[model samples]
Target: MPEPPRPEQPSDDKVLRGLVGAGPSQLSTHAALRARDASQPTDEDLAEAERDLVLVRRRYVPTQNLPPGIKPAN
Candidate 1:
């Protein structure tokens, strides 16, 4: 008599996520999860992002040099 066919194995994405106790909709694949973890912002990356937001004035004028009517504090 012929033997019955075996059940299909789950994909690597499903198997790996299941092993890590992650929900089904969390990540698509193990490699993608690893990549995301590895690509987290470092201290340098944070500093660079902050630096990008800073506005550097090309020319500086002292408060004493301002016009009489204009108040720099206000």
Candidate 2:
């Protein structure tokens, strides 16, 4: 059997808008990851937090597509 084609990745803006419980200034999963792991990362703690955040977000949040009950905001 052949595999079905995957849908395209949504724009970063759309992803941010669709994020549940996200604040307007809050960074996206990837952004947070960069923040925490970067040399500065506002020091270091935030970088570690951001790295952990990436893991958590990848597991729970939608990346290229969303799971049920996680529809994108218009």
Candidate 3:
């Protein structure tokens, strides 16, 4: 039998809003869920999400848009 699928990530709308309006917590949670081994997402999909998360980190990791000391519990 084939391996199980990965979990579902948040929708693009939520992702965009979370990335733009909210902090990195939402994005990190979505990433963790997508990384799970049950949703059967393709490698390409995972790669794309990884790229998006990297870009997000680049945008916030330095300037630290998050509230002071409020780290995404990822």
10-68, model 3: which lDDT tens digit per residue? 78887667656854655576675774645687999889887655443533455556555
Ranking by TM-score: 1, 3, 2
Q: What does candidate 1's lDDT look like per residue over 31-52, in tens digits?
A: 6678778989999999999866
Top candidate on lDDT is 1
Tell me, by TM-score, which candidate is best.
Answer: 1
The clash count for each model shown is: 0, 3, 6
Query: After superposing candidate 3, which stretches have Cα over 4 Å from the reference?
Result: 1-38, 54-74
Residue 72 of model 3 has an lDDT of: 55
- Top-down lDDT ranking: 1, 3, 2
All candidates: CA RMSD in angstroms?
13.7, 21.0, 17.6
Candidate achieving higher TM-score, 1 or 2: 1
Cα TM-score of candidate 3: 0.22
Write model 2 residue lDDT over 1-74, tens digit each, in one string. 89998998888777556554465645668976775566464546787786554333433544576545566554
Model 2 per-residue lDDT at 13: 74
